[model samples]
Target: MSQLILHHYPRSPFSEKVRTLLGFKGLRWTSVIIPAIMPKPDVIALTGGYRKTPLLQIGADIYCDTALIADVLERLAPTPTLYPAESAGLARIQAQWADSTLFWTAIAYSFQPAGLQSIFGNLPPEHLKAFMADRAAFRANAPRMRVPEAIGALRLYLEQLEAQLADDRPWLLGKATSLADFSVYHPLWYIRQAAGVAGILESYPHLTAWMERVQALGHGTSEKMESGEAVALAASSTPVSTEGEAFLDLHGLARGERVTVAATDYGVDPVEGALVLSRPNELAVRRVDARAGEVVVHFPRLGFQVQKVE
Candidate 1:
């Protein structure tokens, strides 16, 4: 089996989600910390243009989104499953809500004046300016939640979660921790990063305890890997074959055709390649990077759009 190589930064909440999953599965992985903002030449060389943080790479196969990356991890270590049978469907639905609605709300709430200080207070002015501009571009065309709206929604959401965790239940889905816990944990975790806005979470005792439990999972065993080394690893390795796998094509595009895949929400920069795998759940493209060699980049079909290059 190819070693799990994660390209992520320390402050990325999605990266934390994957890290905790790795810890839960007790899987050791190679870690490559990429820049929080843009101009990621090495990342672009492998992903083509999908610049989302915390991509999972197994040899030449690069998984773009965390949703797909979670599936890949679950497949790799199935014992501590992300989707317990009892709460599989509900967990997926709740996770989707947390990743989208809850996440955006937390962003609006945590990036306010005082919260901004907590995040960019110590950084150089240029660094803060650059990060702001990079994120502005990233959030283009996505629905935004203003701080006022985010505060109200956050309070309501936290209250609901506190109620859910009532009676000292161990995990979100009864006995075992599922994707819902990780997904919900990350957005609120982001909220906690800003000490100013973080106090909102203190109002909910049960929710706080749940957050502590999730944090206790901790990141699993990992070793540092340089960016060039990660790219070189991709250059030398081979993408696992996806042949004979179920192909569920929603778009008219067929396998082997030139196509571009991009996120439907934010980070809309398209990754161009030959359509390699089109399934009900995933879309992959075969692209050859001069630096990274032949590589297949994969994305989840849910939030990504696939367009055949005319």
Candidate 2:
């Protein structure tokens, strides 16, 4: 197997999820720190256009979205599974809700005035301004939660978690930690990323305890790789599998058809290429980049919708 290369910035919550998974799997990986905002030229070189943080690079294949990244890691190392077998379906459903719903609420509450000041107090004026503007644009179309409403919702969610943990189990579902634990950890991790908001955890003893357990799974083995080196690695290696498990034919579209792929959420940039793979879980588009050579960017089927762009 080729060296696993993760392109991410430290402050990204989703990236933290991947990093923790890396630690849990005990997989050695290469890190390529990327900018937190747009104009990720080097990253676009490999991904064609999708600009989400914490992209997973395995040789010439680039996996976008943390949900898919988790799947890939689980497939690679199944022993310490992120998805538990006893209630696998339930675990997956809960994880999905946590990743999308719980996460946004946490962010909404975490970025309140006090937390924002703590996060940017030390930064230069221009840097802080840039970050704010960048995030605003990133979440342009997303709905905003009022601070009071956000706090109430978050508190309710925390109480529910407390009830789950009260069962005398270490994990949310059962004895072993599963995807549910990791999914819930990252957003709250973000809220607490700033010192001021971290104190709020004291209100929920069970939630805090579970958080400690999640943090213990460190980024197992990793060496920093420069952005340029990561791009070169993508340019040099060939993708292992263009074909995945299942396919959905549309508009009479076939494997060799010329199509475009893009995420349904933020960073709506599209990648145009020869459609190489479309499985029930993901879609792979083979695109040729002059600087990065040929690379295949894979997207989880759940968060993305595909079409034939004429």
Candidate 3:
């Protein structure tokens, strides 16, 4: 198997999620740091237009969304599984909630004026302005939770998490660290990084201790590689064969038809390609980039919309 290549910037919350997954799985991967904001030409070349951070690249396959990436990593390294069989369904449900509802709430609270200053304090004035503009554009058409509401909800969520851990179990879903742990960890990780804001966690000691355990996992073996090299690697390799998996289309689109797969929420940029595989929970589209040649881009069925191209 080709090296697992991750394109991410350091400060991205989702990137931290995958990075911790890599650590938890004890997998070796190549790191390709990308720009925190837009004009990400290399990423666009690989993903068509799905500009979300921490894209997982394996040979000629690009995996978007950390939810899908978690599945891919589970397939790659199954021993210390993210989804334990007995608790998989429950774990997934909790993770989905954490990734969406809890995530937005934490973001809203973490970007309060003081937290915002803490985040952009060291950056150049122009860079800070650009970052704000870029984020505003990203949030366009998306409903934002106001800071006051987010603060109330975030406190309630943390209190609940603290209660869950009060029983003295090592992890959220019991003895093992599951997908729920990682999903919940990233948002709080962001909040913890912001000055003054992390004090909120002080009220929940159990949650804070659990977070330390998750943080201690650290990013596993990773060596930096240039973006051009990763692109060349994709150009030179063939996508993993999908010969035997039967296409199961929930949408009316058929295999070999031109289609576009996009996230239903924010970061809704579409990736247009030939629909190669559609399962109950996965969708894959094969597209060819001039630099990367043929590559298969994968997205989870949840949180994404598939449409046939006219």
Query: lDDT of each prediction vs. the true structure?
Result: 0.90, 0.85, 0.92
Best by lDDT: 3
lDDT of 1 at 303: 95
Please provide, for model 2 over 1-310, each residue's C-alpha lDDT reduced to its tens digit, 9 standing for 90 to 100: 4688999999899999999989988899999999987789999899888887889999889999998999999988887988777968878888899889998898888788888887778888898889889888877687888889988898899888888898778989989878888888898899888677668678888889889998998888889989988889888898876555466775478886788887776667788888888777778888899888988888888878677867
Global Cα lDDT for candidate 3: 0.92
* lDDT for residue 29 in candidate 3, whole number 0-100: 95
Cα-based TM-score, every candidate? 0.98, 0.96, 0.98
lDDT of 3 by residue, 1-310 (tens): 4699999998899999999999999999999999999999899999999998889999999999999999999988997999988789989999999999999898999899888887778999999999988888877788899989999999899999999999998999999899999999999999977876778889998999999999899899989999989999999999988778899968777788999999988888989999998878788999999999999999999999989999
Winner of 2 and 3 under TM-score: 3
Model 3 scores a TM of 0.98
Q: Candidate 3, clashing residue pairs? A: none
How far residue 24's Cα lies from its native spot in candidate 2, in Å, is 0.8
Error of 2 at 145 (Å): 1.4
Off by over 4 Å in 1: none
Deviation (Å) of 21 in candidate 1: 1.0
Off by over 4 Å in 2: 243-246
**On a 0 to 100 scale, what is the lDDT of residue 177 in model 1?**
91
RMSD per model, one decimal: 0.9, 1.5, 0.9
